[model samples]
Target: MKVIVFDTKPYDRKYLDKENERYGFEIKYIEGKLTPDTAKLAAGYDVVCAFVNDDIGAATIDVLVDVGVRAIAMRCAGYNNVDIRHAFGKIHVVRVPKYSPFAVAEHAIALLMTLNRRIHRAYLRTRDGNFNLNGLLGFDMHGKIVGVVGTGQIGRCFIDICRGFGMQVLAYDPYPNPNAGIEYVSIDELLSRSDVVSLHCPLTAETHHLIDAKRLSLMKPNAVIVNTSRGALIDSAALIEALKDGAIGGAALDVYEEEAQYFFEDHSNDVIKDDQLTRLLSFNNVLVTSHQAFFTHEALEKIAEVTFENIANLSAFRGNRETYLANEVCYQCEKFGGDCPKKNHKNCF
Candidate 1:
């Protein structure tokens, strides 16, 4: 199978090429994102592999279909960028759902620790030969309440880490996990009570701006929020207002809502035009990291393996006319339940 990967970085190429040795698939790497304009480059390829921030929207999907691309293999877990509704019966879509939950969970804890202890600030201070300890006081994590917003693999791992710190754990999920071994509360209660709130949910229409002004108002005055999940989960403007008013404590973010344009690229020489992002960086309490929570070596290797597995599965399905591909996701199945109305179909296509 021939695959063209978009938004390729050196690390991406390195790991993907190493993994491709097993699959023996012809692969092409493109540094540019897979936008509608770039979709034509997938012509004659069996599959187009994209990353988290790539534009796999309706127009791009149409172009891929027109250019004889049969499948979209997302190297990352999130597929919110893909227009699944438009791609139904047109092309198959697959993704790497879980690629090192510990990588993201550990990164979330690192952000929380860095923000709480002001380690970033202290590092700069020490480097500048200032040894003042004033304004550097941080509370103990022990005996504090932590609200975990999602109890998926990553969220569960975070909860375990918080428990190891002797912190009380309160979780909120629409579908609570029975095996989570933690208290499940309403989102409002979690916000009002927790000293630290961590988000680990997917971005959906329902979850977009889940942490708006109203929600922020419910949080404890000294509560700190951490997000290693989708960017749009928290409203950046509302967060800024909350920070200005000191409504909550602070935020440690690994993703931004409008990060597609700036996250993966070097922009130190360029003027960052995103005013909200600029304002976010202006706050001393807020710590912003490029969307790299899932950038560990293990995670990248698994992503590459799963991505290639998805392509190989699609190739096998196409040849043998199988009923289903394990990692396949479609609008009908996602919008409804997991049950697709198209019975015994090889895929949505």
Candidate 2:
């Protein structure tokens, strides 16, 4: 099958090319993100491979359909960028729902520990041969309470890591897992009682801006907040105000709401246009990374493997019109007064 991969990076090319050796599919890599302007690039391809930041909205979907693109293979778990409701009958969408959860979970802990212990500051100081220990006092994590906002694979992995540090774990999820081995509490209770609040939830109507002004106010003044999930899950403006007002002690973000415009690109010579992001960079207490928590080697391999498998599975049933080969976009089939083709409703991995 012929596939066009968008939003290509060096590591993406390396892993995908290595994995494609087995599938032997005709793959074309493009450095640009998928958008209306670039949608025509997939004209002759059988499938379009996209990443987390690519825009697969209505307009792009229309263009792809007109150009004979049969399927979409998302390399990431989140599909918030794609408007599945619009691409209902025209196309099929498949995604890697679970890559390496440990990659993101470990990165979240790394961010929290670095922020709390002032490792970044100490690295800069000791490099200049100045070894003063003032202002570097950090509390022990042994007796601390870490409130996990989601109990999914990534959240559960993070909980296990926190337990390794002897931290008390409290989790909050609408569909709580009884086997998570942590106390399940209300979001309000988790916010008020946690010494460290970590967000691992997805971005959706109910979860967007989950941590807003009121929720920020509910957190302990000395508590630390870390987010390795979707950026829009927290209100950036509210977070800025909280940081400036010292409402929360610190924040470590590997993602941002407005990251699509800037992240994964180098802008060292340009001025930052977003005032909220600019202000966020001025705070020493806040740590910001370029949405790379899921960029580990293992995660990249799994993403490529699952994405290829999704395409293979769909390609295998191209002649069978009765199969729900659209993957998770089957929900949109109801709009056309037709039953979804797939019998099982499980998420595609």
Candidate that scores best on TM-score = 1
The alpha-carbon lDDT assigned to residue 168 of candidate 2 equals 96
lDDT of 1 by residue, 243-346 (tens): 99999999999999999989989999999999999999999989999998998999999998998889888888775655578788778777766666766445
Give candidate 1's error at residue 18 in angstroms.
0.6
Instruction: Report the lDDT tens digits of candidate 2 across residue range 1-349.
Output: 9999999999999999998998999999999999999999999999999988999999999999999999889999998898877876678888898999999999999999999999999999999998998978788999899999999999999999999999999999998988666799999999999999999998877899999999999999999999999999999999999998999999999999999988999999999998888888899999999999998989999998888888888788677765545344554443333453433433221
Give each model a TM-score: 0.97, 0.94
Ten contiguous residues with the weakest lDDT in model 2: 340-349
Q: Give the C-alpha lDDT of model 1.
A: 0.92
Residue pairs in candidate 1 whose N, alpha carbon or C atoms collide under 3 angstroms: none
RMSD of 2: 2.9
Whole-model lDDT values for every prediction: 0.92, 0.89
Estimate the TM-score for candidate 2.
Answer: 0.94
